[model samples]
Target: MNNNVKASINAVIVSAVFGAVQVANAAFIEDSKLTLGMRNFYYDNDNREGGADQREWAQSFKLDYSSGFTEGFIGFGVDMQSLVGIHLDGGKGYHPDSNTFTPSDSDGSATQEWSSFGATAKARISQTEFRVGNTLTPSLPILIATDSRLQPQTFGGAMFTSKEIDNLMITGGQLERAKGRASTNSTGLSVPGGTEESNHFRFAGADWKVTKDLMLQFYYANLEDFYTQHFFGLIHIQPLGERQSFKTDLRYFKSSSDGKNGEPGYRFNNNGGYAKNPGEVDNTTAIAMFTYTFQSHSLMVGHQRVSDDGSLVWLSQANVVNGSGRNEGEGGISFYSFTDAMIGNFARAGENTTFGQYTYDFADAGISGLKASISYLRGEDIKAVSGSGPDLHEVETDLRIDYVVPEGPLKGFGTTLRHGVYRGGGTSIDDQDQTRLIFNYTYSFF
Candidate 1:
C-alpha cells in the first residue's frame, strides 16, 4: 500500500482500539472495583544561546478496574489510562521540542498541545499472568520503557510473565507498537529514527535469584534490521555489618545488525548509512558499578568501554525498519545523571569513559521524601578522522528536594532541578549546556 494509505489505516486502527477501551469500561468494569490516579507536572527547559526554550504543564490520569475473580482459579482484569498535555511556554520555533507530541506547522515549529491514552486486558492463573495493550515492559535489550515525563511511555502489544519455577522468573513478549510520553499516536518502534514497516517484535528473558542479596538476568531482543541485542546483568548486595550495605551492578550488552540492515533484512547492504559510518560495528560493551551506603549517604563508581569498532553502531539512533531513522532521545550511552539510567547522550567514536556519583537521603534528617544526587562522566580518545575525533568530555550535576505535604489537599507535591554540560564530537553542532526545573504533584483514588 502507499504511504498515505498505510497512515490512514494506522489512524483508523488507533481509533478502534481507543473506542474498545471505553466500551469495556462501561460494560465490563465494575464501579465498586474501580481505582483512579493522576499525576501533574510543571516543566521548564531554558537555553541561553539559542532562542529555543521550553515550558510545559501536563497531567496524566490512570484508571484500573478488575472483577475479583470469575469464580475459579482463573481471573480477569483490565487496565486503562487517559493522558493530557497543555502548552505553557513553548512556541513554533520549538518544533523538535514537541518530541513525543505533534510536529510543527509549515513554518518549522511545535504545536501547542496533545495527548494519548490506552487500556489493556489481563488474566491471572497462579504465578503466571498475561496482558495485552498499553503497559510498561522493561525487558532488557529489547525494550527500555522510559519514564522521564509526567506519564511513562508504553508499548502496545501482549506480554507473559511467570514465576512458577523456584528462584526463577521468566518473561516474554511480542510488541507491535509504542507510545511516547508527549504524543498519543502510537508508532511502530524503530531503532533511532527508523521506519515503521515491520510490526512484529519479540523478546524473552529469565531472572534468577542466586542468593539472598544476589540476582542475575538474561534477555535477548531482535529489533528487525536496526539491530539485535543480548543483555546480561548481575546485581549483588553485601551488608557491611548493621546499617551499611555495599551494592554491585554489572551489565554486558552484545549487539549486531539484524533483518534488513541486519543479515536478514532485504535492504541489507554495505553502502548504507550504517556501513559508511566509521565506528559502526557489531560489538559489545561492559559496565561495572558499585555503591556503598552508610547513614543516609551513598557513593557510587563505574567504568565502561566500547569494543573494537571505531563507532558504536547498534546503539546509534535509526529507524528500526528503515535503518535510517533519527535518534530523538538524548543519544549515546550517558553516564552522567543517575547511575541507574544510561540513556540520552552518545559517546564519541572509540571512546572509553569513567564515572562516579553520590547521593544523600535526608529522611533521617527529618526532611521526609527529600533527597539529592550528582554524577560525572568522562570519555577520552574519541574518534576524529577515520576512527578519529576530538575526544569527548562531559559533566552533569543535579539537585532536587521534594516535600510531600504531610497534611493538605496537595499532599504528594514535590519539585526538582537538573543541570548538565557536554563537549566534543562531529555529529551535530559542538557542545552545549542544559537545565531543567520541574514542580510535580500526584494523587490516587480508589
Candidate 2:
C-alpha cells in the first residue's frame, strides 16, 4: 500500500474506534451482519502433451462482518474480511513452481496453509459513499478481481460510488497494491512479464440506465508507466413474450502505451503473442453478444475481434518477484472479456474468435436447484511470434453443472462440477483437459 492510503486508513480507524464507543446506537448494532463461508475445491489437469500435470485439493474459509451505518446525516460503518486456506493435498511433483493453485514451500512443494485479514472503513452522506481498505474486490469494465481459486484477489486502495443523479451511477478508485489469491503477501501491481512494479492504478466509470430495458456504460483506466485504456459498452433487453426475452450486449476497448511502457523493466509480453513494437502496448478489441431465452432454456452467441497491433492488456502481477527473489504466487487474473475461458484467454494479436453457449435450468422440469451449461470457443489467425509464417489456432470447450439442496437439512449447500478441454497449435500453451469439483456452504449470524 502507498503511504497516503496508509495514513488515511489509520485516521479512519482511529476515528471509527473512538466514535463507536461514544455513539453506539440501534442502527449500528441492530443491523449488523456476520457470515462464514466454506469451500472445498479439487482441481485436476491432464496434460495431453509431454508436460507436467497439476492436481490439488484444498479447503478455504472466509469470515465476513459488516456493520450498518450509524444513525445520522453523515453515517459511518466498517467491514472486515478474514480468509484461510489449507492445503489438503498436493504433493511435491504435482505442485508446480508457479503459484497458480497453491503457495509453494522452499523446496518447491505446496505450503501447509496461508491466511490473510483486511478491513474497510466506509462513510456515507446522502446517496454517495466512500471506502478505503485492502479488501476491495471490484468487478468493473476496466478491472475484475480473480476469484476462481481457493480465495479471491483483493486490492489495497480507496474507492467511491455515487447515485446522486437519477438513473445514473458513478464509481472511481485508485489502487496501489494487490494481494494474490494463493499468497499471504501483498505486492505492487504490474502486467504480465513486467519485473518492475507500478504502484499507481486509477480508474473512473459511470453507468446510465436510459430506460427500463436499456443501459450504457463508459470507463477509463490507467496503470501508471504501463498502459491507458478506455471502454464503451451497451446492453439492451427486449421482451418478446411473457416467457421469452432477447438480450444484446456490445463492448469495445482501446489501449495504448503509457510512460516507460517499452523500457527494460516495464516491458509487456502481449499475452505471449506478437506485438507490433515488441514490448509496447497497443490494441483495440470489440465484442458483440446476443442471448435468447425461452422458459428454462437459453442460448448465447458472441464474436470478438482483436487488432493486429497487439493483444489485449489488463492489470497483472504474475511475473513480479518478491523480496526473496521468488515468485510471489500471483499468477491469476480476471478480465472483462467473454474470451476469458477456463484454460485460455483468446486475446492474441490478429485473433478473431467466435463463441457460443447453451444453458438449461431444471426448475421447470421439477428439479428446482439444478443448472447446466456448455460453451465452446474457437480462435483463428493468431499472429505468430515471428510475425511471419503460418497463423496459429486454438479452441476450448467447457461444461459445467451446479446444484443446491432446496429444502433439506443442507438447504444452502451447493456443489459445482466443471470440465474443460483446450487444444492449440503453434503456441506456448499445452493441450490439456481440466476438471474442478467444488463444494460450498455459508452460515449467517444475524
TM for every model, in the order presented, reads 0.77, 0.94
Model 2 segments more than 4 A misplaced: 1-24, 323-325
lDDT, candidate 1, 1-446, per-residue tens: 99999999999999988886666554444432554555555555544446456555555555544443332366667676666555554544443533543323334354355556577887778989888887654535435666666556677788899999989999998877766554455566555334334566778899899998999999887766556778898999999987799999988877676655532223322212123332233656677889999989999988776564433433222233212233232222212113333222433334466787888888898977778887777655544444333443444344445455555676766767666555533433234555555566554453
lDDT, each prediction: 0.58, 0.92
Which structure among the candidates has the greatest TM-score? 2
RMSD of 1: 11.3
**lDDT over C-alpha atoms for residue 22 of model 2:** 54
| Deviation of model 1 at 429, angstroms | 6.1
Worst 10 residues of 1 by lDDT: 329-338
lDDT of 2: 0.92
RMSD of each: 11.3, 7.5
Model 1 ranges with Cα > 4 A deviation? 1-71, 91-109, 136-142, 262-281, 310-344, 406-409, 425-430
Per-model clash counts, in order, read 31, 0
